[model samples]
Target: DFTLEELKSLRVKQRYSFRDQQYNGKFSIITFEEFISIALDAPRVVGIYPEIKNPVFINQRVKWSNGKKFEDIFVETLKKYGYEGSYLSKKWLKQPAFIQSFAPTSLTYISNQTDLPKIFLIDDTTIPTQDTNQSFWEITSDHYLDYIKEYVVGIGPWKDNLVTASNNYLQTPTDLVARAHAHNFQVHPYTFRNENQFLHFNFSEDPYNEYDYWIKKIGVDGLFTDFTGSLHRYQEWTSPFLSSEKDAYNLLDKIVAMIFKVQAHLVLFFT
Candidate 1:
């Protein structure tokens, strides 16, 4: 409803009524550039994962001067900040990012512009894709995964869809994760919260237990949680890496070796 300048005047507040309101109205709303700046200023290498929310709706309502859709401006903004490279490339690792969107067309459109990895987001089983009008089941099919894998490096589905629940208790987990992995696509499920309301009874209402089940049991590549601190602690405790300079160098050595192996293969193929 408001322009960027007008939106900045508004203060952010907790969305859920159950949460504390102490910081409400204390901080002003910020632009996407400000969000990216925070990541760039971090002490360690921090990656940004920005979502293209409701592209179809936004394009319908907003008009750009050059007749560009919302996605063009979004990619241009990232380019303006010098963010361009394929996933895990030296340039990308320095300022890593994954552009995620539920719209397959938008992702394919941007694939022509940027090589930054994209993740396809899947909604509930009852919901159809915003752009493709494909059902959740159809999209998760082996055939569909094969097609989409060309554009997206991963899929971020609603966690419940990965592991169904009945009466607030988990049911037999689905093989979607296995199928996605078979296609060499990363499986990153979303919306893991610490609150009991979001937990299944199988987790004993413990967030760590939930994390263990998804990460260790289900073997997911990544997670989207409302509590980043909790997730960080769980990951640090479960998968601690040696912080010594020698260990760091050893890790980099292996990475360089892998890169050389890949380059050697490329040379062989071209020769």
Candidate 2:
């Protein structure tokens, strides 16, 4: 399966319209399992954000034996390949990840089998949920949020849901963020990209500004980005984890600057 020919065509292109069209001819479609393997093979702890995308369509198209649902196979595959653990456990950090879906039933179904943390994704108000066909208004109700809070560690809602847009300008931020935070639920807005068209004018077309708004103003735990490497770099620059080498380097730099200042003062005094 590890053929040079296949790897050569392994570039990734935009999966949507209004994105950079330059790389459309270069990239190949990748699977969730392959993505997991890539993360697992990384030198340090690499996190993965895998959504159970379009389960209704995938289940309708794909088949299995012994009456196994796609959910069954999917959870089994992850567990089989060593992805079993609760949220933020030692085992989970070894393969840091979150399983997300719009269908609440799917989350409940997998709950019986695995303790891995799950996130229920919310779309716009008019769209019906995938499994139960509940409208977004109903699913997003306070009662429902309180109910699902037990099953899910977080909610991944559309970014617009966080802040409404009125005539292409941002309105007052919604209480949804505050309510969700009250219940100790993490809010991770979806599908942030790095294009002028994707960003609103409020952020000055800088992705970091958008990140600052979401992380500081709105207060989300994580973000779902199209460019994982860019998010990694942004997080490292702004809110870097205190690794030993980083700490040592920072300390050394501070000491060296202090020594230079001290030497300058001594030379002035002696002269």
Candidate 3:
């Protein structure tokens, strides 16, 4: 394996053939500190959602002179960058962040170190938990949700797991979102994309339809989308604020038309 310095020398490339490839070698890999800086420097209040991926594997291969676990290092970096506070707290709204991980043990350990909201990531049904070795069914059970609710503010599950599909057609959605809501936990499903392959047939190959089903029908708290622009457009098209703004503009146009008609009548009368 290459060191961080060696890794930075490599350029980024698109994984899928359908996606844009023009900028494949345009950018190099960025360090975690650089990632944090990008978020901090954004004009708007953009929240950072960093994942503690493969903690079991990372902890085994990586070592520190200070004798800290992978989770400790991760939390220290966040704290160092002033990413502390519960969900929607004043400090959080100023520089919001969510610490996510697939390993339950890592999340639990980090809870003692920082108050930043955490999300428990769920994998495919067939995959077992990397740390606890718990089956998907076991971890998603109401009993497990009850236990995990104390540590994490939400769960980020694989979208297909929440609503299964066969032959690319969507089936009935599971009650995971409802159950999560019942436990006062937010549910944010993952990796929404605009590409046809990533979309289910029920959406008629339209990303907006998929967004409608998930946002309106499924009632998820939020979505983790690959194409942020498409998601932003979808939200704007469906936003109540946009509707109200349109109504205000329409009212102003009608008033201006009435004024012009009245002035024309006055001119004719005076002439």
Per-candidate RMSD, Å:
11.7, 5.5, 3.8
By lDDT, is 1 or 2 better? 1
Give the lowest summed-lDDT range of ten residues in model 2. Answer: 1-10
Say which prediction, candidate 1 or candidate 2, comes out ahead on TM-score: 1
- Candidates 1 and 3 compared: the better one by lDDT is 3
What is candidate 3's CA lDDT for residue 242? Answer: 88
Lowest summed lDDT window (length 10), candidate 3: 58-67
Per lDDT, the best of the predicted structures is 3
CA lDDT of each prediction against the hidden true structure = 0.92, 0.83, 0.93
Q: How would you encode candidate 3's per-residue C-alpha lDDT over 1-271 as one tens digit per residue?
A: 7988899899999999888899999899998889999998988888999999998998899897788999998998998988999999998998999999999999999889999999999999999999999999999999999999889999999999889999999999999999999999889999899988888889999999999999999999899999899988988799999889989999999999999999999999999
TM-scores of all predicted structures? 0.87, 0.82, 0.90
Task: Kindly report which residue pairs in candidate 1 clash with one another.
Answer: none
| Model 1 C-alpha lDDT per residue in residues 93-205, reported as the tens digit of each score | 88899999999999999998899999999999999999879999899999999899889999999998999999999999999999999999888999999998899999898
What lDDT does model 2 reach? 0.83
Which 10 consecutive residues of model 1 have the lowest summed lDDT?
Answer: 237-246
What does the lDDT read for residue 162 in candidate 2?
A: 82
